[model samples]
Target: MSPFLPLATVIGCGVVYHVAQKASGAVSPWPVLTIAYGAAFAVALFMLGLGWWGRGDAVRWPAARDCVASLALGLAAFGIEAGFFFVYRSGWPLSSAQVITNLSVTAVLAVTGIMVFGEHLTGARAVGLALAAGGATLIARG
Candidate 1:
């Protein structure tokens, strides 16, 4: 199977997941977050077990510096998760919030790709970016 298939699957699942989450109404964000993370951890553990028990490549631990970096990344993740919880509590519409946040993130990434990664944007990519920007502007106004 091509790589795009899995990527598309993940993106589709993410959309459905967010929609389901928003439809669930205003529950306690902390408990919800806890459960979500717990489930994710469980999945990771299951994968690890499979790799260990079945494949016999149990654990390749990271280096000390990598561990420290991961710790910092975990902190950043927690911060963003907490911020999203607060934003959800603020009664923002899910669609609007998702669109605005995604567009802003995409814009930042596009700029970063060009500047830091030295990526060349093709004509098609430029057109797509322009369309995305225009759509974001309309969404922001609405």
Candidate 2:
């Protein structure tokens, strides 16, 4: 499969996610999170069904132990969304909020990638990250 479709889906959904969170700033985050997660669950299930049919294969649901990662992912997703919602509620402009969060998370993950994953910080990657950092600084300053 071409990466273009997957990347477009991610970018599109990210836009919608931020807009929805910002628009629903007046509501309780928990309830909103509940609804959003429920919808996400439904969508995941639907996608799984579609993939199974498309491939003409039996469902390959993960074992209980294998689902542990998904459980952790759910918790992390909740925390991320709630944190963003609170940030928006605290008067963070939509433009800078995601920019700051993404850049900060990228920096942390880059460190983790290097230290824990033993991934090399190649010169090209370093320059890209530096440029991102500089852009984030400008965004935050505004």
Q: After superposition, how far is residue 72 of candidate 2 from its true place, in Å?
A: 1.3
lDDT of 1 at 44: 78
List clashing residue pairs in candidate 1.
Answer: none
Clashing pairs in 2: none
* Per-model RMSD to reference: 3.1, 1.8
Which candidate comes out best when scored by lDDT?
2
lDDT of 1 by residue, 1-142 (tens): 5789779988997787666566655566777778878987898799787775456675888899999998998888676566666666678777677777777788798889999999988899889988988997788688
In angstroms, the error of model 1 at 100 is: 1.2
lDDT of 2 by residue, 2-121 (tens): 769779989999999999888894667888888888998898888788785366577777888879987998888889989998999999989999999999899899999999999999
Q: Which ten contiguous residues of candidate 2 have the minimum total lDDT? A: 52-61
Evaluated against the true structure, the overall lDDT of model 1 is: 0.77
Ten-residue region with minimum lDDT total, candidate 1: 18-27
Write down the TM-score for model 1: 0.75
